[model samples]
Target: MSVLIQYYNDFISRSADPRVKQWVFMDNPLPTLAIIAVYLLLVLKILPLYMKNRKPFNLTRIIRLYNIFQVVACILLIYMYLTAGWIQGEYSIGCAPVDWSNKPNALRMVGTFYWLYCLKGVELVETIFFALRKKFNQISGLHVYHHSSTFFLTWIGCKFVGGGMASVPSMLNSFIHVLMYTYYYMSSLGPEWQKKLRPWKPRLTICQMIQFTILIIHSLSAFHPECDIPKYFMLLYLPNLVLIFKMFYDFYKDSYKSKSASLNHHQREKKIS
Candidate 1:
């Protein structure tokens, strides 16, 4: 372990910049692919057993557990974010701008990034539970895509983008998770309670879209003369986000339209019958 740490430190030292070092780490490709493989295997193995039992999906318990996990994880992430500032000798949240390429700070950032990446892996349990409960309809393409992509993206961020423009999206994502998780906790009880609270699911989706947009813009900004990010990777990053945003928007619109149409159809059928 000590030798591995020394090797990582030496590699970080020799790299041109934090982003370059991160890219090297992401270039490994093996760990992320392995995770996806395990996720698929687990889903295949458990889904049939869940179907055979015919158990009703238990939303309440799932929500409670999810809420607990998010609340705790959010708190811990916030603490780490603050500590990173302290390590940089910045006493306040608004102190000196963070230098993403600074070695000590970059190392700390990578460590936190790893924590967040592992959290994404842990979150796979959400999908597994859904599969087990036979709530397959809820497991849409967006759902699976987001889960799988986030795991890989977080891995890439930790390994290749930990200290550069890419970190902005990561930091924003953590903040959003705080809000998203709290909303989930409140909405978990039942429809009656959710009606009273009137939580904004659309707003959450909008926030997510905004986050991706910011990330894309930030990646582009690295093209300026002083920025160190390679042109090739920057070019690669932008188009993927465009596709991601379009997919999320379409999913949002379709979901609302489908729900409304279902309600209208139900009313019409009642009148005709």
Candidate 2:
């Protein structure tokens, strides 16, 4: 383990810019991981055990506010990314390498990247809300894993490759999340509207799968001999995205198929009667 840490330190030191130290939490990785660890523990173990015999708390107002906040934050980040370098006049469509120097635009982009990481942490509340509401069944492995992996993954991107090609996926994901949070925001309205919004939820997952597919391709393109995007960052992002895609797709298939089958069985029984 010490040998592995030494290797990662050597690589990150050489691969990352000195300017990375300027960002909050960039100098120390452990605290971020620890926060995520505590989050997982609370959601999976401590909270559930505590909430077991209690009445579920209604988090209607809080959840709705959270959804709106995420959407607004994502929109702000998207706009900043476009102006900072992601737009046509500013950055190439192919790949943008890390801005090792701390120019103003680079600093803004880096700050937004950090903000995105923090937002991922805040999004963990989604699962916690479920636990609070006693929707424990919704807190599946995929749900927990997705929330867990994103914090570390985005931190890696910011710490090592802040204002570069990786931000593309970050931007794309923000766009999807705008719609996603919008769905959640509407669903938080009430059961009547929530049922109306259920049809849109699957579309959100499909969008997520598509985002992962594009992200995998984008990360792989960095490996082209001409591109300088770090293999280390790609190493962190690509495999995890592939796993995410599979998990989401499998859940979608199983869910949709079961619903269809049950509906068909019920219809056939009605016809028989």
lDDT of 1 by residue, 1-273 (tens): 999978877765654344544443354557678988888766656575657668756666866887788778967876776566554554322112235554666566667777888888887877777776677777777777778878877776566555444555666777888888888788877798688666387778888888888777666666777656655545656776787888888877887657778999999999999
Tens digit per residue, CA lDDT, model 2, 170-201:
89999999999899899878899989988877
lDDT for position 52 in model 1: 68
Candidate with top TM-score is: 2
C-alpha local distance difference test of each model: 0.69, 0.85
TM-score of 1: 0.73
Model 2: lDDT of residue 233: 75
- Which pairs of residues have clashing backbones in candidate 2? none
